[model samples]
Target chain A: MHRIGDAPKVRRALVSAAVILSALFLLLPLVAIFAQAFSAGADVFWRNITQPDTLSAIGLTLFITVLTIPVNLVFGVALAWLVTRFRFPGRRLLQTLIDIPFAVSPVVAGLVYLLLYGRNGWIGGWLDTHDIQLMFAWPGILMVTIFVTCPFVARELIPLMQAQGSRDEEAAVTLGASGWTLFRRVTLPNIRWALLYGVILTNARAVGEFGAVSVVSGAIRGQTNTLPLHVELLYQDYNTVGAFASASLLALIALLTLATKAGLEWRAARREA
Target chain B: MSIRLKNIAKTYGKAGRGVSRALEPLDLDIHEGELIGLLGPSGSGKTTLLRIIAGLEAADTMSDRPSSIHFGDRDVTHLHVRDRRIGFVFQHYALFMHMSVFDNVAFGLTALPRKQRPSSGEIRARVQRLLEMVQLESLANRYPAQLSGGQQQRVSLARALALRPDVLLLDEPFGALDAKVRQELRRWLRHLHDELNFTSVFVTHDQEEALELSDRVVVMSNGRIEQIDSPEVLYRSPANRFVFEFLGDVNRLEGHVHDGTLTCGDARLDVDLDEGSHELLLRPHEIKLDEHPTELAHLPVTITAIAPVGAEVRVELEADWLAEPWLATIRHADFERLRIKRGQRLYAIPRQWHQFPAANQRSIASETMS
Candidate 1:
């Protein structure tokens, strides 16, 4: 007599059932988006994606991603190095604060920035006196995007850097390597893969950000509306085909992000081996 | 370069609360072109002392005790590791994972400032020469992950020496290798130390590694240096009981001494001592096995085991008087003549024994058996 948990047939059935259910739960919506996107044929899909406002939204999304990723890359590495390598007062507090952006709701984050930088807000008066517009403008959009993607890279890097310890860096220092040389030759190469992973995640999140950018964007046509906000506008106009088409664009980006992530993970595993 | 450590100490945590004193105040001077081994068990602060000299860790500072380190004439206590011109080989070879062996060795040479840096060709040639010295020229194109542990360690050595550092420090350089590979690397290190003629300090807990490799061994325990001597002197005349025990296997005989005789249980030995309790120490080879009881320091025992290998036969003996079993190593020729076997009754006569009044006592009062 076999134990119920030890039976191979039962175990295989249970595993297969769980996997199939989860796959359907995750994949069904993705498949629906694409099917509805091309349902009206390629011409309608192309027309929907190439509309002047849609094109500008896509451009705005790309612009936010391109600008913020580099900024986050530098900030993440510096923050990871500072938090992992040095011993100082408030280190634990600083580390905890870095993850606050990830925990905060994006809408709440947008509201917080609006309260600080909006035209009539705290820094707003100083900015208005200087005739600078941040609220409901491109700068406000950029600021909220930066806030949303802030923690991605550093969160990936901090634990890995901490676990690697300071042995290799110490070794480099003893060999007469200057600080810049130590970071370039020793530290960067070690953390490069994790850094790439963080950039990818940050790019995906920045491109797909909806609530935070919406709160600050003012949604002016072809001005500050990102791709997700444009999808909202198209849906609000009752243009079902156009809305899914734009939605499909974001979905396609999500798929590409997942593929790249899996590929990088495989490369990291092989490198570890 | 000659090195000196003056009044160096280290402590961790707060003074009044949860605190651990890692190192006590110490002073040491190492001569130029000499290879010294810091030998101790774990938590003995041997590695801590080596790190302090390499400038990886700072020594403690006190109002009255100021810590300072010197390399030749330069006072390097406050200097960073890069400016101190030292080279360190970690126990786990910390070779850059993404770079080839050639690139790893060339790291230091290429990292020099522009005015002081060597040309690309010169850097390549220098790296190749160092790799040749370590016998890793064939694997120069391979990454660290592609090489074996011993091969990785050889690359580490080549990389350390590429900069022509004033002082080279290795922390358990061969600790990660198997026994055979460890022996091979030890010989290689000794050869390199001599040919290059650089001052070097290495830390190890293995007594054999310390004794066989260093010109001088600094025996350490409990964050303090117990003795500093040539290996030959250390083995023959350990400065204290801890050193003797740490260096090799030691047998002990404990009893009360009255007049010139020491008695414990049913055992009696002729010892030169005043009336008091005494403990005697003997190396395995110092004990003699005999069939008849002698008038000297002899005790009756039963042969528990005999393992004859190569030139010597190791015999294990047990008696009521011994708190632990005693081992005696005799020649193969003697083993054959005596026909030693398990379960046979025998007498162990210690040819010589050393006595220290306490564990930390320095003077060794010895007596010879006739």
Candidate 2:
């Protein structure tokens, strides 16, 4: 009953079907974005970038991304080390809480932050007296980006840290290394590549955040709007050239991220070598 | 070197927990400049004992030694594992995957304090010398993953000895290598011991390895020290049943003693003393397998199985003597001289009266049932 068909041919057919489906799912949106970007000429792209509103929006988005990425990178790795390496009470609960942004919709994460930092909300009255604004401000936009991308670094680093055998540290300590030295000399070198890989991934996610930043940003045209929101605003104002141009800029970041991922693979191969 | 443990017990968890005991109380004295083999099956507390001796673990109590280990009077039990100055080679070698073999061997020197530590040149010289000792100087620049299993083990050994530790603890050092590699390393380890003469304690279940390598073998079973004797002393005269069975193969014959000689239905055996409700233990090769019998424990037997293992051949014998089954071993030359056959009847005789304190008496009856 099992010998009716050739096994290798069936396996190839199934594998190719999976490969094609995966390619269509991941590459379709990039194809559409590229198609839209090149639909207009470089002259139209330059015209959009020169517009005052488009320029401010681009500056604002890059500013928020530059602010948010390092914070998320440091914050994510610290949390990853804490949750994975230490024995602490409420560790399981904290692990689940750290992953809440991944489980919740980005819109909901933005709303939760907005409610906490709004004019009449908790911690908002004190800030109001100090003339500090978060909701509808660049602070709120950056905060929303942080919330959405919080788990990326930890999700990458924790398993790598855990998988590194504890014997090296034990051996170090037995060899007269102090606890700090053990962590520095043995633990750090072992996980440095993986930790750097995680930082790269988290920074990419923080810079590319869209839905959460848009909800908290209040869609301020030139001040608080990020790149994704800028693209949408340009589209609604019957500015197809500006919208596609900004979209192409975000796609460039994506391409850089893909290149970084490829570089990371090469580094990994060299490490194994 | 020169260690002592008093009433050392290690119980893992609560009584109602899955395993009640990891190790029971034990007392041991390890001499300086002598290699001791801790022999046991798996889960037999050999590793736990080695860890305790290295001060990597705290015994539940050590009143005699103040819960401490003293390498020439430096109390190290309460000190953290780093300050103990004991070298350890784990079963997996545990070499740093990222570091070169030179750096791995230099790790301990790099880990030492400023005033107490050796200089960079001194560390390099020491690593080179240790690498030469392990015969791994050619592979010093390579990482651990690039080396063979034996080479990795040698690097681990080099790293451990780099510290010039007072004592070395090896937890099944050759257990990870292949059988042929294990045999070669076993000889290399013995040669290295003669060259350096460091106080070493190794744990292994391979009796042949224990006998061939160490000056003394400490046979452990059920978390306690069953017997500690020299390799020759242990094989020629085992202390108990577990030691006898664990060390090598044995054949048993049941008999009762009238006066000072053991008597069965068709056989009478000479013994050092009277034996009642006792079983006789004998080694197979020591027995004489000849058809023209003598007056003794002789039985008309047939060969059931013939297994030729290198120089020795284990000839399983089934006899119409009285009660149960028996096995006998003969050298290749002896089996050839006797012309033993599978179905032909032959006289199975005792080589000598090999007796010891009997354990597993109930299990002997149960063995027949099986």
Candidate 3:
């Protein structure tokens, strides 16, 4: 009567292996971050967090994330709606293109933006004459962060929206609901959970993004340095506790995002059941 | 509303690379308050035609004669689905999952423009009335997920009727329900259609549903309408072979006809057919079985299977002449009198049969027992 992989010995072994691996690769690092951050006592950790440069980096990171979330939210919903609801030429191509951010290395995307909008680059030369500084500035940091985080919301929504289909929206329209009314009442409610999950993911990626931001931001302290980039700067300056302090902040955000995602998934499953 | 569709057609792909036609340019006139069933198998353009009538899809315009649709006196070919003032019930119900049954029913009323919208009190009363009509007032507070499939379907019906549309279109409305639930829903929908007096069109592949529910059934196949008639007329006289085959179970009698007789293997039947290969069709009910062979038909068959269900007993017959098994339906009394059983040998007599010749297949020649 035993099913495949259902032996007590085998099941126990698999469960224990999974738990050990998770503890080593995931839980241990999270614990180590807070441990190192407070190794020099709470005062040093507090000092590192309250430093003017760290404060500025935190503010800049929050600003970029706040802007990036709404932009990607709108883009993701619109893209998911367009590709799922309508049939047209190049729809498959557009769907594939949305995953470009996920496929291309973040640093390569940053370089591409730099080459296109940097001072010596194509669009940058014209902008430079107008004194528009995109690269090596807060705008450059924002741009690369947006590039890395753009796909999260859309990626989360596409499969879900596709599975749900457009029948509800079509029903609304046939019942005298206008475009905006249908979207607001039917489509929005249907996709709200996935949309929120996407935004949380986008926020997490935007806050933690370093590779692309470093390529474009030039890591100017208190000016264009994001939180992740500032952590690297502190680490390179031989400040381990300071580095871990910033990393702990990121770890908290990641934890919060994971919690929110799990909560949303649990609610969604209950609603479906 | 009376619906008139003129030269409506649909093509799926672009013109150059293997464009497939979903529907041909054809015209149809549906009378006001008529409950028409677009009966067809899958990919038969019944749904396409319904969507075109609902303005959910645009019919292709021909170069010579442009396609157009009309609702009563209003020309609605160019109207959006929202502006067309039609109600559509999707196959899967498509009730708003987050909304309660009451809220789902009230959606169309609340979605109206501010100037045209009814008061919240009026909307609530209307929704309540709709829920009552569907016998779902008790479940009005429940979300769609909390309801059974039948309850969800009723909620969708209430939602569609909330707008008080002149025309209601349903795509495979009861296709998802169990047999008993589907039957109940079909009767309920028919009652609602009669009471509301709306021009209703529903698509279904089930012949029994179409025949029982529709005032007129439009039998379609291969993107073409084979026949449009009342259930009685459709059952009694189908337009062609496709219509006959699609309507109900048809047993084929294929053999060479010569000198007023058709012969296949050792079995022979008296047939007044031309001297050539011919095929005859008979309904299960049109077949009769006896212990001894009759002079008119010496068709000997072995009783392979017996299903004594419902009001009749269905007997499956097999013979050397039959390329496939033949089914005969007899009354329970007859089944008992004959005491038929599996593996028993019997004689089959065609009480009535129909023939649709290969050439000029539209004409039907039917013969009944003298």
Candidate 4:
């Protein structure tokens, strides 16, 4: 007996349509980036990557991603733990607040931070007295990248931790485990997979953040220009090969992230089986 | 260790809105090495009381009388669960999923402060001994996800016992297992409790489990203790209507008594009672089915269903007088002698009955048919 939508003709048609659409829309663009980067030969692609501004852009992007991950990891774990484990007056409201970074446009979030911390802004004027420059600098780019990537870890964790419940933690405490010991030995082990998945997502978002960082970085060549901003700069300058080379780098990182995620999921499924 | 609870109560949610009472102010004393069972239906606060005793929840503080808990001579009302030295087994077996059976059981011992932590060799020996006691020594390397429900529960029990806690609390320890496994685990837990000689209290909704495993059963309903007595006393003489009904299957006879005869619909029984409205309760075993109406009763009933799977045959009886179906359990010999079958009409004779008067009067009157 055939199940719903399981007729041979219809199944073949649907499967072919999905495969063709994915190949054309998703796979074509990824292949084009590397192809275009190497169109002018490997020597020009190598020269473009070795440019001073391009090197600085890569360094700044790596710095921001490195800083953003640890900060958000701590914040996300703490927030998820608080929301899932305890009952408070504003718990529902706090849960809603966690989605602000995801709900609002990244550019709008960058603007909000700029309005609060930029020169001539409310807190920025006070900071200007102290000569603490935040906006139009590396700190500004890092802050906005953190803002855009804040929710990934927490969003990945909250539902999983909620489903798992606090019973193991409660049992640990009753067994004379101290606060830190319980978190390390019981809570951490239980949440390690989800936590790792969340960290992977946060890293992906942090590395690829463009809209918010672009709005704040001021695009100072070799100074605040991250990889995405530098690629746009190269494109406008008619350096097509250089722009594609940087895009290829970003695509490589995305592919690596996807592969790692797939590997983790396969391992988790095998463990369950 | 013996346990004491004084004026313990719990009110959930914030005051004024969404507030509900979970437990009422009550006191209880548990003797050392005693296995007590808190038996009640769902939402009866049995699990809440057990959690409170485990320090997982705090009892409300009454201004007039402060709530307190004591373990032997130690006042532990405000003590943290980690410092109170108690072990709790969750209903779901809350075993650490990532840890092997050996690691799970050795967790509490290894988690002790460095000063009090046992040596690795000693911890290993203890965990092996616990696994041997639970008869899971061969499965020590398996994770919780790889084990069956019964196995996971045994691991949970061993983990709870590894700490050598003064009191061990289990919340519906066997509620998640199959009937056969539940029975086996119940006997095994009793044996372990007796051999170890540690105080334990468990919560359960199954009456047979509570009656079979507990030295004394605390029957509860609506957040109050209806009675606390040994299983034999609790079964033989329940304290109130709630206790009697909650303990086991009960058949109700609601009618009016006139001139020592109680009549309900087309049924009548010679009952010793005042001339007024009365209700009587009868247990399944107290009912006897006969082919002809007896002089004392004329409770005509039809066998709606019959189940002879267990040691005793259970027969379902229904009549125009009953608001609900009644059950009568008889021996296999009697079942064979009567050759009872479904749709067969029979007379129900009450060998014994109990009566509780109306509101404002709390007393039990037991009568036996002569």
Candidate 5:
């Protein structure tokens, strides 16, 4: 092939170098966690991972992921549909507010929840009088998880739905589709891949969330502790194998997230093709 | 079904500030089973009018100027698009990219409310029938992305017809196809309309497409209809100068008329008119070229170019008195007989000419015997 630029060799070299460096930067930590987790052998790694506290942490993480994904799915789709399909006052402001969780620190999000639900905080006393526990409990952990992961689905969907536009929906409507029928047959099919994409990202964040869950979880050994908090607790106790093993489980979840996302993206590309 | 639109108008943005009228308050009646073409340039309210009829847009609503749109006897101006029972084909086809051609055509049938909905087996048969109509049955299972642009548009057509809507509206149905494909689709759509005998209103900016496809063509510009007539009448007797100029290529002759003589620069033509500045319009086929001047209206010019294509021979004429070169299309036999060539001097005689006094007013007159 003929060269098309003044310094093609140098440009190619620079791009390759950047790509290689970033790939290493991203992959090194993932490799190290698995390496350290199994350093004492598979038997020890399995033992650490199978411990009752570790198992409970995994369960809490899965439970939170399961609970949060569906809620965010509904909220994300509704918000995206409203923002993109209508012209109303404060529409831009609504879009920006939806992105707040992405911009705010996860720890700050947890603190905001605590300020609203802590024992001495606003509404916390009322909740205590009713014998409802929120702070340092599953509810607090779940709330923080939902807040931080809220934007994933909406953010993915808004631009896509905007780009797709309302033409198909209008076409469907003219063909005698009711509101629900239009959504199920026209709008939903169009956004299904993006919704899957958003769900996967939300699931990954809900499982691997650290700061927010850490603040509200109170590191409660087997109750409020998620996988990340349990990893921290094991490290603090100098149970290195246990800590790495728990960390590896989180890494595995992240890998599964990546795989599912990749699979969805492949299907989306095929659909487009 | 027949449609009657009463005083329908639309405006965008805040009134009296940055508002622009997209459609003037006007009434139109389309007979049942007639295919009408809304022909105009961009922003001329052709697509806007079509959308309003489809219930995709709400017409202007004011206490003093209420708009009503009717399909047969049913008033549907305030009705939702789904309830209005109109089938629309968008310019981009808008076929569901994720759905197979069969499912895309089945969408409308399945979307009907429970009591009105057809059985699954009935839907399957209806979809297959529509697919057969559009000649896309073999590609039933293929997704829209798998087919070519023309095929996708065909699938869209079948889908639109699935519900058996009272009226069908196509917005530049063949706009995205190639020239050959556009011609093919035009013929196909015309055939389908005739076979099904359904009322349809289509919007197009292509004069040829509009004239060829429409039973009656409505020429519009600046949110107002310039003329509405059969294609033959519209071509032969345009209602106004805008309609005349917009329909085809026009040669413009600007001059002052005085004492039965029209003079522009050095060129002169014996035309009886009031003493005032005027512009004469001539179609390419209206000007007859000869070796010498005739007794009627004539102008002398030198040939600049000659293009012999299709059935007509187009000759370009230039003269010092002419502001813009005049184009003339003659028969092939005439071209061979005259031995027309570049730089050949010839005289142009006007068989007839048209003029517009108030821009929108039509004033066509034949030259009087001197």
Candidate 6:
């Protein structure tokens, strides 16, 4: 019996090794940034935090992330429900299209936004004629972030919704439940945990987004600059301590996201047990 | 309430894709408060009939019957499953993974109109009562995943019965459980049926389970009903050969019948006869081994094989004057007392010759399938 399960131990060892290697490989740059930030004295760190422009960048970044993630969540769950629960014309195409953001380069996503909503672009030109500004603004930065992170929640929810099924809904219907009651009392509770997981993933992806935001954001020092872009701008201006201080904060946030997600799943398992 | 199915059938796919019939045109009546077991092998359309009753499925010609299912004063054949008030227990339990056992049971109850929803306290009391009915009161706070398979099914049973459904349908409720658990649940279910007596329809392939648990077992073969009778009647007097062979072990003797008597193998017997070639039916337990005939003449035969099964021994024999195999069962003690050994010459005496008329004979072709 022990001999039969020994193969699983070997597989576990290989997977653990691969995971550790990949984690270190991915996390080193962020670690290096934090290390560089700490290289300087405390006075430089104070200078970085107290700077009004830096404070504004951090505020704007947090604001955009909070705003964009929920948008992604709404669209993602809708997209997931549309794809998994119903079969319609172009369903396969719609499924692939929902995931296109995952494969698309963030910069390309920014360009698509530009072609549609830039100052000289389709809707942009019309809006601008009436003094309505979308580009070089906070809303524009959020739009780009939403486009790049749209797939995260849907990706997490699609397989879950597909597996959990619509049986309970049918059961509810046979029990004389109306549509909304069926969804609220039957479907929603079933998908609640998966939806929470999707929301978490969307928040993580939204907060960490960088490149697409760079092109769409005009990088106005105190207005459009997100944390990652601010770090870049500060680094280029030779404010090394400020750059690393901000980078460390982001690194901490990313670490917390991973730990929270893991903790959530562990707690879920325990509750189920 | 009465379920009247008239020429009800179902077909899959369009003409170009090659049509497949899931159910053929058939008629049936299911009365209220009756526990009807649809017994069949897989793909026999028993499930289709249940689904049709539950309003989950619509038969092609069912719409044409203007009067199909009359639940009290209402016509429900064309209604959606939502309006059918049918409680279904799926084989997998289908309990919502995220919901606690109580919540799972309370889901259907909560689906009522806002004004009709029981008070929170009332709902809790009702749920607790149902959980107790299924003997799962202690597990009420636990979610479905936390329970064992038996417990999950019990919770599912509690949930299905929570709303006081007009009809309860179970698609092989214990089909997924282990033997001991299946047997235990069978007793509990039988008790529940007697207590509440909700109109129940269950589909099963287990012959013993159908016989033991159902008020009446409807044996189906190839999407057709072979027989519908109580277990005792089904065993003692089967409607056809398919029913006889399906309900228990049987020994078929090949021979022709004339003038109400059939010479079956080496045994001459009286039987009901109509016309054409005929045969006689004999169950293994109905046959006895004797050195000399008491009433019927003993047929000396070679004991080909002896198989011991727990407390019983099955002896296979071939008579010299007959071109068919004969079998008889004896208790382990009886087998030992008789000193049965393989390849030994013995005498076989059948206590009764069951008549195989044309209707039951039409089922012999199906017994090959059984």
Per-structure clash totals for the candidates = 0, 0, 0, 0, 0, 1
Off by over 4 Å in 1: A1-12, A15-23, A269-273, B359-361
Q: C-alpha displacement of B261 in model 4, angstroms?
A: 1.6
Q: If scored against the real structure, what TM-score would every candidate get?
A: 0.94, 0.85, 0.96, 0.96, 0.93, 0.81
Cα lDDT tens digits, model 3, B1-370, are: 9999899889998889999888988889999999999999999999999998988888987899898899999999999999998889989999998898899999999999999999999998889888889999998888888899999998998889888888999999999999999998998889888888999999999999999999999998878888899999988878888888898999999999889889999998888778989899999999998887777788899999999879999999999999999999999888888888899998998898998876326646556453
For every prediction, compared with the true complex, DockQ reads 0.84, 0.69, 0.84, 0.85, 0.79, 0.54
For model 2, how does the per-residue alpha-carbon lDDT over A154-233 read when each residue is reduced to its tens digit?
78878887787577776787788887788788977887777777667666777677777877888887777777888989
Which segments of model 2 are wrong by more than 4 Å?
A: A1-28, A50-98, A117-144, A161-163, A270-273, B14-16, B58-66, B114-117, B254-276, B320-327, B353-370
The 10-residue segment of model 1 chain A with minimum total lDDT is A1-10
What TM-score would you give candidate 5 relative to the actual structure? 0.93
Task: Put down candidate 5 lDDT per residue, B1-370, tens digits, no spaces.
Answer: 9999999898998867799999999899999999999999999999999999998988899689788999999988889888898889999999988789999999988878889899999999999999999998899999888899999999999999898989999999999999999999999999999999999999999999999999999998989988899999999888888888889999999998888789887677888778989888998998888887866556889999999879999999999889889999998887888899999998888777888777566566665432
**Candidate 6 residue pairs in backbone clash:** A173-B82
* Candidate 1 local distance difference test against the native: 0.91
lDDT of 6 by residue, A1-273 (tens): 467437987979988998899779886787787777777767777678778988998898889888987788788878888898886779899988987888889999888888888888999999989998887888888888888778888888899889877777766777788888876777777677777887777777777778888898888998889888998898999888888888887888888888988988997899676
Residues B1-370 of candidate 2 have per-residue lDDT tens digits of 6766666778665557665555687777777788999999998899988888776777776355444456556666677787778889989988898899999999999988788898899888889999988888998899999999999999998888888888888999999889999999999988888878788899999999999999999999879888888999888667778888898877777777777666677666655555476676666765667776665444566778888888888877776554655667678888888777777677766656455555533222111100
Tens-digit lDDT track of model 6 for B1-370: 4556667777766678798788767777777777889998888788888888888777776455543665666778778888787789988888877789999899888878889899999999999999988888898888787899999999888888888887789999999999999999999988898799787889998998998888888888877778777888787777886777778777776656667545655655444555446666677877777655444334577888899977788888887566667778878876877788877776666666565555654332211100
The digit string of per-residue lDDT tens for model 4 on B1-370 reads: 9999999999998887898889989999999999999999998899999999999999998899999999999999999988898989888999998889999999999999999999999999999999999999999999888899999999999999998899999999998999999999999999999999999999999999999999999998889988899999888877788888888889999999999999999999998888989889999999998888878799999999999867998999999999999999998998888889899999999989987675323446555564
| Model 3, C-alpha of B75: deviation from truth (Å) | 0.6
Residue-level lDDT for A221 in candidate 3: 95
| Stronger candidate by DockQ (3 vs 5) | 3
**How is the predicted docking of candidate 5 categorized under the CAPRI scheme?**
medium
Best by DockQ: 4
Reference-based TM-score, model 4: 0.96
lDDT of 3 at B366: 57
Whole-structure CA lDDT of model 5: 0.90
